[model samples]
Target: LLELRILLHGPAGSGKSSFINSVDTLVDAVSHDSFTTEYKTNKIQKGEPGTFYPFVFTDIMGLEKDTNKGVGVEDIKLAMKGNIKDGYKFKPASTISKDDHSYNNNPTLNDKVHVLVCVVPANTIHLLSNETVTKMRDVRLAARDMGIPQLAILTKIDEACPEVKRDLRNVYKSKSLKKKEFSVSLGIPLNCMFPVKNYHSEITTDDNIDTLILSALRQMTDFGEDFVNNLYRPTSSLQTGI
Candidate 1:
């Protein structure tokens, strides 16, 4: 099985569930409400032989401020256990001290996160509050600390104006400049960001959303390649035979 532990984190109502649902229709069962995914996994099997085995996707509750003090954080830690079996063991998100709490769970400096997908609302490109910016920055820092490859998904693009879309692209290009500035002020390296428009469409034609989603998946595949290259060198002991 080509197992991957992909994390989807962002503020409430950022379309995290929607993005996961777009990847596979089966995920729709667990996608709902503002914080519907307390903790769940959706599996997609590639029907073709010689192709990668089923890909399991774990969806956790949205990480809010003070999530570590709540039950939701423990749920995320529990989910990490499954990833450990897949060769990626994350430090339990629950064990981190309250004072040292971070948005992204960093079990160790050498932690290998296959991919970190940060969701942002496309309609509100520059509508982030001070607290939101801080949280976003911390996520970026945590990804950097774990040496994980990362990408940003700008959701709800259909609801955004052209001007907002342009601004969103610029912010993405600048690593959400305001957040990047804060990271720099705090001495954190910014992770690379990519802007993807993930939306649900009524039409099922060739020009429909499936194409866009497939493109996004391809981008993720490329990012995964780079992450594996960085965290596990070809000559390293961790290298797999597959």
Candidate 2:
């Protein structure tokens, strides 16, 4: 089994769960709530045996402001610490506290996350507030701190005008300028990024949605292959008996 721990992180209602569902039909259990995933990991088998086998992907709880101060912040923190070598095992329900209604704040630095997928809405990119832009930039910074490869997926593309899509990409490119100094400080390249148009159609195949997804997947695989080859070692203890 080729286990890959891909973490999806973004603001609430950014279509994170829907993206997971697109990757694997089994993730349909996910919903559209503000916090659809409450500190849980859903595993799915990607590709076939022998060729690529089943690579594991985890759908993490969506992040929000003041998450660290909330009740579930601890759980979120813990979940974010996992890496490729030692994949995540779901936490038992009995261990969770019923009193904590706030989000989990338990992010651990040891979490071995392979990739960080940031979901952004294409239509709202230009309209985001300065604070939101800063928050998005912070997310990228956090990913860099964890040494995880990061990619931005632009969701709700079908809802945007063609001109808006063009403008969105330009906006994204310009926004990188604001983080150029930060990237330099971290010794990370700022241009290693890809754009994905997701949720183009209610029907997966309509409006060339599959083509967009495939293009995005190609970029992701390229990044993932390099990340896996350079940063991680194969785990011998990963038994397929489950």
Candidate 3:
């Protein structure tokens, strides 16, 4: 069976990698400096050996405020169309073209991104630079043109709000995030925005963390399945023709 492809993108240190690790015990490379350069697709292994879940996650380098640094917005557009390949290193100076060795000329429906999740730090929403927000919105518009569903993941809620920090149950009650403000900023609806704390510095998995992660994941799969089911192309088609 074909697995849903979920693509994650956002500013530096927004917890994209950490969220993936929390969702599925996969080992994704992370750094304190917010440097993730490789394009990687992660699949969750099922209980049985050599088996995987019905969905996969793709992680890319974080977006930077500088136009000449970090990942370019054009590269993200290509990724959504499945034009980029795994392990492809991002070049800030240029984007991948048809002649690039890392380009994927033939991409199936499974290779295309079913859902685009923008991961950002909850506490830093108000502090995001104008350039970064513009970059994010640019990518969102591209996804919209391609008919891809988009959502936002607000990470580090504990650090963003003291009330939530005391108890995760107070997530909705806390007024710190100002959901509407960020919703307007990112062009994402209140319903599509999800708040979750990624698993970090914890020796064992916590119920609260798992609940939040699973909640967002369930939503992702739901949106992804809806997109895949509505696709005009056959599931087994190898070329997207885009």
TM-score per model over all chains: 0.61, 0.59, 0.91
lDDT of 1 by residue, 1-242 (tens): 25655667666677777777667542222333345435454455455544533344555556454534222433334333232222222232453333432333433322224666777775664565555556666766666656666677666654664543454344333433344543343333344343445544532323334555666566666776676565567777766633
Q: How do these models rank on lDDT, best leading? A: 3, 1, 2
Between which residue pairs do clashes occur in model 3? Answer: none
Q: How close is candidate 1 to the true structure, as a TM-score?
A: 0.61
- Which pairs clash in model 1? none
Query: Scored by CA lDDT, what does every candidate get?
Result: 0.51, 0.50, 0.86
Q: Report RMSD (Å) for each prediction in the order shown.
A: 7.5, 7.9, 3.4
Candidate 2 lDDT tens digits, 1-242: 14555666656666677776665432222234244634445455445533432344456545444424222333433444642223222232322443333323443322346666777655555565554455556656666765678776667654555543554444344443233443343233555333445442344333344555656556666666666566534552322222
Lowest lDDT 10-residue stretch of candidate 3:
25-34
Question: Residue 130's C-alpha lDDT in candidate 3?
Answer: 94
lDDT tens digits, residues 1-242, model 3?
28899999999889998888787743223223246898999887776768888899999999989998878999999999998999899988898878989999997776789999999899988888999999999999999999999999999999999999988989988989788888898999999999999877766767887787888998999999887766645763522533
Top candidate on lDDT is 3
Off by over 4 Å in 2: 25-35, 45-53, 65-77, 83-111, 129-131, 162-204, 232-242
In terms of lDDT, the poorest run of 10 residues in model 2 is 83-92
User: Candidates 1 and 2: which is better by lDDT?
Assistant: 1
